[model samples]
Target: MNGKVLLVEDDASIATVIRSALEDEGFAVDRCESIAARDRALASDRYDVMLTDVMLADGDGIASIDSVRAACPQMPLIVLSAQNTLDTAVRASDTGAFEYFPKPFDLDDLVRAVVQAGGSGDKRGEEAEAGDGLPLVGRSQAMQAVYRMITRVLRNDLTVLVLGESGTGKELVAEAIHQLGHRKSGPFVAVNAAAIPADLIESELFGHEKGAFTGAIAQAIGKFEQANGGTLFLDEIGDMPIEAQTRLLRALQSGRIRRVGGRQEIAVDVRIIAATNRDLKPMIAAGQFREDLYYRLNVVPIVLPPLRDRVEDIEALAKHFLGLAAREGLPERRIDRPALALLEQQPWRGNVRELQNAVYRLALMARDDVIDAGTVTAVLGDPAEAVMRGRDDALGAALAAWLGDNAPAHGTLYHRAVSAFERPLFEYALGQTGGNQLRAAKLLGINRNTLRKRLGELQINADSFARAE
Candidate 1:
């Protein structure tokens, strides 16, 4: 808080606000309007941190950072930009800025970042070569945080854990890290742990030697070896078997692995990027997922926001998918603004993957080059009905699975099913309302007394859903 700060921004209003906030926090602040002034200040005096806006009156702030870094290489740099795109985030990262705050950012968060930056030394590292075909796309504020997190890990091999609901493009995040990172030249290997049988997951990851098991006709290389000098993306990591988790943990810890039955430990030079749709914390508490392994993999957790949360990005994402479909031999199509509006209103329960599929379907089946709301409805059906259909399908499948697995006594089946359905429904309401009984009851469209009675019968601790501030 007592560190000297050099603030470079062209707009007097913004500069004043930032300078005043820093001064209030006990920081000595110097104001500058352009990159030239920023450079002059750097030469005249040493500042603990430099907070600069991207666009200046004379030249681009981020582009001129090389000169600033050369003059004061040890000083931590924090970038402020109104250009809140993924490209901008990557550029700030390339300059080795301590943090990048997109314009319209929280003032308190910026002050807090400055406080953290003051105590830190230089974070400048080798600049990551920017790639044109960036896999992930979204300029929304929610996506800015994700883009920043992605850039932070591009120059390093820190183990990353991508968490999101299914179809939220978790693999795309893994791909972006690999493609934009230093490992771009090497192979990018991905394995879905959930798709693979639990028995074969270990062999799939660490390989197996000849005669290791009944099916081992010859020695085979595993994903770790295949992705040597690059990245190994373990998708659906939450579904991996307990035994495989142990082996994975050992390999991650030691930087080496052994064949299923081999005596020699083969060294691997691979970056581990794991992703899962499941909440690992709950799994850890339930003793299903290993706590130690969770900690090892959660070093740099990147939580991808669900589609419902980033509705603003729906238009861009839909257009992106349409372009992809066109390149893949499907008929090109453009969605009109009205159609896009309809899309943004729908609760995309299945997230981006589902949207992509819907787009591809529209591209293939649209009557005209321009997709209208009627065309969308014709191809995808009414948005509300689609959501209900998805939920009904999922519920039917879940009920089928439950009945197949647990065939209760004839008289108790109805009671058991009602309890099963009501418990999760009430829990979801409570969770959404943060355990406020009145709010939860309103959310569920039920009486508070009825909710209380049901909670008592279900033995659910409503207080557990209330998050600590």
Candidate 2:
């Protein structure tokens, strides 16, 4: 771990602090205030490790990293930068940097990375082939593909659409993209499309001018304005209102917006990433979703696998949750081999989120510190059987009854049955989302305007569903 260090940084204070910390660990430090000085130091000295900042006084550190690598092919290079974008992180990764640390980074992490860089040890997020910095937690091929896709989108601002079931961590993927992209230094604003009320979704996304509505007290910034120069993550985007979808599509195409009551158009620069659990094709066919908007958002689609598909990764995910539980002072705990095996065999209807909830519950409720099969069995109760039964008994019966009744019908009867089934389903979704047209639309995998039109056709009143108990 002890070796000679070359530090390339423009900031004098940061260099001195880093040098002092490295010196405390019995390593000789050669500090360079600029990339030019760095080249001289690298040529003259055979250092064990070299650290360079992305933004340097003379030239860009990232640009110089390639030359440094060529000169010192065997030497490990650590990149430090205040630029802190997904673009920087990915560039450093692509250049084969031993480590990439964003500015205001933890001093201890730097020391540990330095020691590891000087040595041949593998870090938590590193494998022989894949060298990601974030602890995404799964080592399965499913996750490897995910990592590759995420890394691909990190360098650019291409709109990304993350498709995954709930609790599969779609937002985390969005966050990773934002953190690794050129906009890393900018704000990352996230809004759940299904959580906002339909009436307010317009104003929420695009700020309203004062007196635009009865409640307009002052001019407020919307998600687009707030996320200027960064990324806007729209969770459950399939739920966005149809009317709002029109406005959003305009903004995405023109990169400009006009407030609710204001005439002045404001330009914005923001990356858009959207996620949804529901299938959207049927909604599009049903005239509840816009085909053009779907095409725009689906520019770069990444589908996250459900937990059941990658059973090999269950133990790692469970242990990660357990580790989190232990850190939160839930009394030290560990899952036994049998318990882990049992988890991998589960149906995992709720996917990773369900597993996390179950693991945390087991960690807290287990009689012994080491959780065994009995504890997992007792906690999960019936291995998601009840959930399957609930769905089969109700919906399965309904489907069976419809098929039996419609078997004699001729000439493509799917349309008739679908029409019969959709009315109640739409009503239920509207109720569940508390009549929030946007959320209900999202829940139905359609657009808000579509939901509103449907309501009028069916004469469904949403005001009573404003809140659900």
Candidate 3:
């Protein structure tokens, strides 16, 4: 047998399909229908991996995850759940299951997880702390999977590959990981592989000695060198040239780099967090990106949800942006309930970034302090008649709109809104003043102590914002 599989599933049809697939792949699969049967099998035999369903006929598969680990401490357990809720996904990560597959999962994908689990860590993985205040906010089931994936890699130095559509906040995720990780004190150097000319990509990443080439009049540190103690965010990595990819792969493999036209090898201790809006597998097939490099950067992968998939978060995100626009010296404005409803109904192909820009534009264009549905529809370019369509019916629109898709959580939403708005507001202010806190405060017309309080409350490190602002 290539490897042993302990399959715990009560559904006969699903179990038969899984067993057939594993058996075809040369895995010796022992199928059990209940927790008692699973326990008995584990007691009598050893297995390389375990695949357990979340809802077993005789047990709750999601809750049984930890107990399964107790029975076979070294076995990597994969959770398959029909529940497929946000809570279920979080529980799977909490229990340190190697992977969580929702019901109706692709057989091939489940097989891949089982095979991959052969080399995964044995100990129940650490649960990612949610203390950073959920920077990537969306309680949607899709976002839940993303959050779980993000938590899995927080404490490790694993190279992360974040995949998402344009303006989906890929860089934000990278920044969060760096800020939350051990390298918070180090610099974060960002390089856009797509933006740089192909000719300059090498020097941009690997540095160049004086007289290395034309315009190389002085020795300059590259992104890799500057990020030696921290993270190097490589955005649009799928656009990298094949030649640069080769050098990057070699540098990553050896943990050292030789500057252009220089013989000295400099050792670098930097973690890589890369993002791409493009699907790299297709690029690899086209001979554009290197396969080995993809594996290296994708040691752990996270995919962000598009705005359409998590529209419920739009209201909160909109309110936060509205507050930000005000802080940016735009006229202070409040979004009325109907305006929020009207905002939610649009097709936001541009995702969160589009929504933010729209809100800012609305703030600038709205004629009154209270922005109503008419303004939102007008800004969204709906029919002119739809403007102020329900201005008289604004009372229940926003709350009812939110209630339709989102179950309000306990506690006041006010603090979270303030925390979300102030961090970026201060960061932008500080960045504007070259990280001089006093100057930033002066620019914002606030006392330095008050600025300090917001930063402390939000767990934001002022030093990190120094360059970013």
Candidate 4:
């Protein structure tokens, strides 16, 4: 509180309000309206912290920070911006700013950040270049919280637990952290706990040795080893078996893993980013999931808002999906205002993924270049029906159809049904990965040899799915 702060903002009212707040906290404030004045002031006096607006009278405040750093390299910098997009937030973080406050931010939070920055000394580092075409979309206030939380963890390797309903883009948040953080140069390995069979979960994570178990033909690396020096994204962590959870907690605690049937413990350097659609509290109470594991992963929790809660973002999200669909070889189509309104009114129980699918359907089925309300209704079905047609209903109908069409003998039904579902599943994975066995195995949370064996047994010619390099 007994430090000097430089304020570089052009708005008189905002400047006055901030000045009053800072002075009331027992700090001396120096005000400047332009980058030129800021540089001049920094050249003359040393301050503990500098609070600057991104847009200034003379130039972009964030862009002009080189001169400020040259003038007072030790001062902690705080960025305030009205442009509340993810790009802007990342730009501010790329500057190594102590904190970034979007427009209409809480005044008390700003003051506390200033106080912390003033006492923390220098917070700058080698600025990481922000990547282009970031995956996350939407700029609603609800999303602002998500963006800010994402920026806070880029500079560190803290464990992040992303919680949200299915299809809420939890993995996207994890990907953003890895792509934008210091680990961008390293490999990003992902595994879904719920997708793998319970017996294989540990081997899928910590690897296995040759002859470790039945059909363990050769030594294989695990997700941990593959993600060394980078990030390991554990999706659906809540569904991991209790025994695997204990091993996972141990690995997190010791930073080491013992391969199955191996005597020596191998050390791994990887950042963990876990996400789940299930609430762990109930599972913990029931002793289904370990309480200790929950706390270890919950070091930094980021809760994603469901799409139904953030209705304002539907239009932007819908348009984004439309663009993506067109780029992916779908017919190009734009939604009319009425169509967009219809989209916003539905309860997107499946969140962003459902909306993206709906948009793709609309793009493919629309007769006219411009999609209207009638087309939306026709292509996606009535809003009420769409809401009722959740994932369970679709799966149930598919199962019923399969059962009716192929009435296998009672004892053989399970095997036949599993093979029926897995054929298309394996094909889809191969198609998505351009027939790269290694990548498809990762996508499906199974071993590479297993995928190859399944493909051969199912008479799937993987070469047909291969893309021209």
Question: How does model 3 score by TM-score?
Answer: 0.57
Question: What is the alpha-carbon lDDT for the whole of candidate 3?
Answer: 0.82
lDDT of 3 by residue, 59-149 (tens): 7876665666777778888988776544566567666678888776789988888888966746764654333343565556677577557
Candidate 1 residues lying further than 4 Å off, grouped into runs, are 43-45, 390-406, 415-469
Error of 4 at 300 (Å): 1.1
| Decreasing TM-score order of the candidates | 1, 4, 2, 3
Model 4: per-residue lDDT, tens digit, 235-354? 999999999999999999999999988888999999999999999999999999999999999999999999988898899899999999999999998989999999987778789998
Pairs of residues at least 3 apart in sequence or in different chains that clash in candidate 4? none
After superposing candidate 4 on the true structure, give the runs of residues whose Cα lies further than 4 Å from its correct spot.
Answer: 384-469
TM-scores of the candidates in the order shown: 0.83, 0.60, 0.57, 0.79
**Model 1 clash tally, residue pairs:** 0
TM-score of 2: 0.60
- Candidate with top TM-score is 1
Which one is best on lDDT? 4
Q: lDDT at 65 for candidate 2? A: 65
Supply every candidate's count of residue pairs whose N, Cα or C atoms clash at under 3 angstroms.
0, 9, 3, 0
- Per-residue lDDT of model 2, residues 324-418, tens digit only: 88888886788899999888777777889888888999998999989999998888766567557667777868877877744746765677677
Judging by TM-score, tell me the better candidate of 2 and 4.
Answer: 4
